[model samples]
Target: MVGRVLHIFNIFFFLISVFLGSQVQGRSLSVKKPDPDNAAATARWLVAQNSWGVLNTISSDLGGAPFGNVVSFSDGKPGKGKGIPYFYLTTLDPSARYGLKDPRASLTVSEYPLGTCGKIDPENPTCAKLTLTGKFKLVDPKSKEAEFAKTALFSKHSEMKDWPKSHNFQIFKLEIENIFLIDWFGGPKPITSDEYLHPKM
Candidate 1:
């Protein structure tokens, strides 16, 4: 009888934790998979819903080799995403370091995290993926855009507020020049930067 009671208590505790964590993160996407046929909407949904992705840069230390690092970003406050990902990074990290030098980078995100794919392989075309290629420019700390970025980033990732001050973490954004979205088997969808930024979602 005691074992069963403990098991029940454990499950209750887990449920509470999950609820609290989502509230803290403010990133519950509802796994709301939009119609895949709409390329712009699909791409925007992928960027807005997912918070972390692989940020690729040209590595200076590795003789200009292509480098990718897992990083966290946010397009805007919850439910009001602007389709432009903002990142908080310190030069100590290779992605930030290399990206600052070359300014050319790409951020890749997969829809697998939305948990709507079920058992399908992540690489499957039906699962959806997006790549944003452009220059990674640092936001001027004294500018108004920096204030907006701070709000956008912290709303989705609350923990960033408590990071060590000594790290010199700076706000950066992708000046998207090209967008590649593959949500179905036909082929890569051609999406222009303007269309992606101003999608009719």
Candidate 2:
């Protein structure tokens, strides 16, 4: 009876160890967010890590009201982000149409999707959010930049490559002029387009 009880205790201990190990592994899989004080790094990190965000544009059909649409974007290949958001868009989508009418737009991304914000409400200031406001321009399909953009977009979103070619998906990029970042409790961080695009090494 003594040996049997010891064997049962060992099994229970082994199970607990496996459970704890899995929990640690799960947490490790999440990307580590940058320091809140580093606004440029934080903003770039948000853009690089997130696969999609809400792109807001001035609606041409809605009497010039602001309209936000969920869309997929890529800054660069994984870990090679240039800090500029590139998108695969088609005029069939209202966002592409609105952007063509009025190039002014903003792309907003949240750190919540990265799974680094543990137990924090998405709206909570500490959750970290970034918005890049600027002119939305379409890249000429034949240009070298467009080639890079296509690679960036297709790499991040594989389905984009197999998307219906009839839809005429064109490459678009935001000419970031201003940045709004909220990573901590005080208020939105004051980061300029230049600062974000060219961070100090």
Candidate 3:
């Protein structure tokens, strides 16, 4: 009879522990959610309607920098494919070469609606944007991944198909280590991977 009572108590304690654990997890998710009109959601939304954005790279010394290069981007997913989050670039492009020399780079995408100031200001609610900071590397041309990158790029930027020796194209995968999301007039906040995936916006 003592053994039976002990077993029952063990089962009861296990059930209570699971219930408490689930509650904690739920609270954690809720707390991490950002403002619905902030930077986190903006990153995901940027990829939704457009396949292009500005790729920014800063030298290790932070001496040279440029903005808005009109580069094509992929969500690392092949339309309806898994979301791996990558970008296709050409080594032939001066920007790509700059990036190769300085692997420390960031990609900034806008979330402004059609028209209105794309600039960020406290009053501008439409000025939501996400800047991803990470290390970038050139994709091996002979690899199968390059084949998919080419197909995806050509599909989005048909003009690329007409360029001669486009085989020199390189895929740059920005292994995102951090995301800085900004809202008009709001200080930028560092977001976690979970927050990046489910941004409020």
Candidate 4:
């Protein structure tokens, strides 16, 4: 009788342990796959939503590389097609001038704070931002590319016409190759092109 009782007890404990293990495994899977989150699409979404972003370019001068500057962008207009961004900049614009001199450049658009103003935990920093790495090439102002850029600019910022114009003004299209979205500090595992466009998770 005692042997039978112990056998039943062993089976019950085994089932209970298995149930707990399964729950843990399920939670692990959920964490690995953050819901409704496609990093590439989300990156494009974040950039589309914001009108302004800081652009980083490589300088040809003897000084240094990775020069950062604030710039305005417009996406998806009558002339400018989707999946492309247009910017209006002058030769006086250090980044633009340097980019013209050296076509190799990487643009970073982020939720640049006017000044950090918030109350949050020190260890867990929370912010919504996206960073894009790609090359920037200047386009002729009178060319077909320029027409698209102008239309896109006017659509996004109607007041752009009021600003002083320059012949050196050029449009740069970022050939995005990588995107980084950060919800916390130290950077999350970047969603690659394949994973983002067609997530297997």
Candidate 5:
């Protein structure tokens, strides 16, 4: 009977841990969410808080269909985000190959990953979502910006530093042309690329 009770206690503790861990936020949000009314801030915060997102590209393999792949990215170190997501991709992947063929892509991120959504469904408007549509251009590996991007990516994803060099990975950034953000009720928020790069807040 004592052994059975001990086993039950261990199972109970494991279940408690699982429940708590599920509430943990994605990456290092370190900062609280901005006001829902602050479109730029909310969008930037969503980008900075999450480490992985769906990167959409025009896929040749799909006979010119929009292909979305879940990819890891970093805008900057933790809270010091620049709102320009940098991805370390290799030509071995279809997204990278398509980007090389045609430099058009978009990345989408959601607030649900940050655990701030509470119990609400991910599709709810109040949950917040950001989509950045832009040209996907490759960064010159020897440029200063590449160094900054490497630091940003490695800071968030340490394993990237040790990724197989044979993979021929390269850095790429999105040149924001349009922003679609929905944080609350009503239509999508109107935020220009300039406002996103240089928010008053």
Candidate 6:
């Protein structure tokens, strides 16, 4: 009888734990996501929340072929985003070198990493993804924009501040000319650079 009682207790405890875990997951998914109808707001939210993305550029060394690299970036400090993604890159890396030879580039970010996608597949239309295509220009180290870039980057990624200075890291910004956003099943939303930069949200 004692053995049977212990077995029942074990099963009861397991069920309780599973129930609690599901509740926690549900709460995380409940985090507010911008309405899909608000194209500009949704695009801005994706850029503002994501810290890293795939940055694609024209490769100078590879006969001008398309090259993509994983990069960390920041739009602004926390909730105050300007909708322009800023990156800290070193010419020691191919992406920065490629950007110098050809400024055309794009940055792609997905909502999956944010943990708000719930059980949806990442490729699902409702999961949302954004790509900002534009010129990748280096920010003059002596310029005011460079200062803001440093603060913005260091604020989100503190380890960047302590990275080796010998690497000669520099700030780069994507001068967005076009924006492609997919947040729903219909298709990509139409968002202009002006609308994305000046979102109502």
Give a tens-digit lDDT track for model 4, residues 9-55: 99999988767854543211112213224555545544555566778
What lDDT tens digits, residue by residue, belong to model 6 across residues 1-201?
999999999999998876786455322222257899999999988887788899999988888899999999998887777888999999999999999888999999999987778899999999999999999999999998888888888887879999999999989999999999999989999999999988887
Candidate 3's C-alpha runs over 4 A off are: 1-41, 59-63, 66-68, 76-86, 113-125, 183-186, 194-201
Q: Indicate whether candidate 2 or candidate 5 has the larger lDDT.
A: 5
Over 1-201, each residue of candidate 3 has an lDDT whose tens digit, in order, gives: 999999999999998876685454321111222344555555555554345667777533346755336677666333332222456666665667777887777777655432223355633544666677777777687898777766656665567667666456556766677887665454775567676666554
Give lDDT for model 4: 0.61
TM-score of each: 0.87, 0.84, 0.61, 0.63, 0.88, 0.84
Between candidates 1 and 4, which one is better according to TM-score? 1
Cα lDDT computed for each candidate against the true fold: 0.90, 0.88, 0.59, 0.61, 0.90, 0.88
**Over 4 Å off, model 1:** 1-27
Off by over 4 Å in 6: 1-31
Provide the lDDT at 56 for model 1: 94
Count of clashing residue pairs in every prediction:
0, 0, 1, 0, 0, 0
Candidate with better lDDT, 2 vs 4: 2
Q: In model 1, what is the error at residue 6, expressed in angstroms?
A: 20
In model 4, the clashing pairs are none
Among residues 3 or more apart in sequence or in different chains, the pairs in candidate 1 whose N, CA or C atoms overlap within 3 Å are: none
Model 5: how far residue 60 lies from native, Å: 0.8
Query: Candidate 4: where are CA atoms >4 Å away?
Result: 1-36, 77-81, 111-126, 140-144, 184-186, 192-201
Ten-residue region with minimum lDDT total, candidate 2 = 22-31
Q: Put down candidate 5 lDDT per residue, 1-201, tens digits, no spaces.
A: 999999999999998776676445335545788998999999999998899999999999889899999899999987788999999999898998997788789999999988889998999999999999999989999999999899999998888989999999999998899999999999899999999998766
